[model samples]
Target: MGTLSPAAPPTTPERTKSRLLEAVKDCDCATAQALADKLGVTVPAIRRHLQDLQDAGQLEVRTEKPGGRGRPQHVYVLTEAGEATFPKAYATLCVDVLDQVERLFGDGAVLRVMDARRLEFQGVLASRLAGHSDLGRKLTALAAVLCEYGYAARAYQENGQWYLTQRNCPAPAVAKAFPQLCQAELTLYRDLLELPVSREARLSCGAAECRYKVG
Candidate 1:
């Protein structure tokens, strides 16, 4: 006879972890108590799965004050990696299906799909800037937007130019991450007559006010 089929693996652990992650994604963030409450499990059970996910580097655990709490409560947030596992797959499936449908439906459908995706990412920066004025506002706006772009951006002002310190670059993540995204940001100030603009930057991160010169 052929070798017996390998025993089916138990899915309890995976199910528990998936449910816990789903709780965080659905809630955006969750504490053990919250997850337990959501999943109708004990706090200890939820904590165990949370620890496992954190250990696996799929979740970021943070502490938050729960008002009457003696100290703080541990809150679990799904790391990008964790969300990537399932939600992204579903999204890819949807997009692939839609593309096939568009092929038969209309040619402009594909262009519309691309335009919508672009607008969704583009809106991130615009929403972050909401309302502000002048250079500080500009720096704050730029930092906020760049952070969304996955760059750990910080700004400092000195002399006349606002220097942006990029702790992380998102370019390599995107085939054409548009390095010019920065230049485009700088150009936003060209027409604003608040103060003369200067692109001359001197690298400094250790000074009291790290030299990010903005006039």
Candidate 2:
């Protein structure tokens, strides 16, 4: 008798797991039930995949008790290791180039380059925020511009002061190496809004998000 062929390898589950990971990536946290609903899979299936991912150190879980709920719900978020698996090229290349620049030119030369970048962004911000006189309006416009550049920025008022919050920093690795970039961002906001700006939190400093307080 002829040799029997092996069955085809299963891939749909793997694809579903990837999709689940991506969905969690887009949110602060996600529950397994929500993930199942979004992915059109059974809760047991979602739990199985989540367990696998957790075992692999790619996911972390937290239990939340919605008040008056029957049971606490499990929420999942990607660990730093998991986030690292996503595509990111800007930071690595930027740091490499900056390292080369420092080796070739000097520390002062790197500072000068950063300063030039700050000045260039100042002009661009001013133009983008033009015609918005009210601080709140200007902040809103500024947030839009930042979001366009991949900052995932939003502006809102709290405690009688306006704030701009960036949920994600597109250049985290670069910022970690060159803190001047963070300073430049604060300076740019101050110059553009024509108001005093203070950095309340910084992503590079391990804050969950980057927050700027504006007045």
Candidate with best lDDT: 2
Model 1, residue pairs in steric clash: 156-212, 157-212, 158-212, 158-213, 158-214, 160-214, 160-215, 161-213, 161-214
C-alpha lDDT of all candidate models, in order: 0.63, 0.86
Model 1, which residues run further than 4 Å from truth? 1-11, 66-71, 89-215
- Residues 61-160, model 1: lDDT tens digits: 8888766567787778878888776733544555556568577878666555555555565566555655766667767776777677776778876676
The C-alpha local distance difference test score for the whole of candidate 2 amounts to 0.86
User: What digit string (tens of lDDT, one per residue) describes model 2 on residues 92-204?
Assistant: 99999988998999877777788899889888888887889888888899889888998899999988989999989988989999887887788777877778889989999
**Candidate 2 error regions (>4 Å):** 1-9, 13-88
The top-ranked prediction according to TM-score is: 2
TM-score of each: 0.36, 0.61
Report RMSD (Å) for each prediction in the order shown.
12.2, 15.7
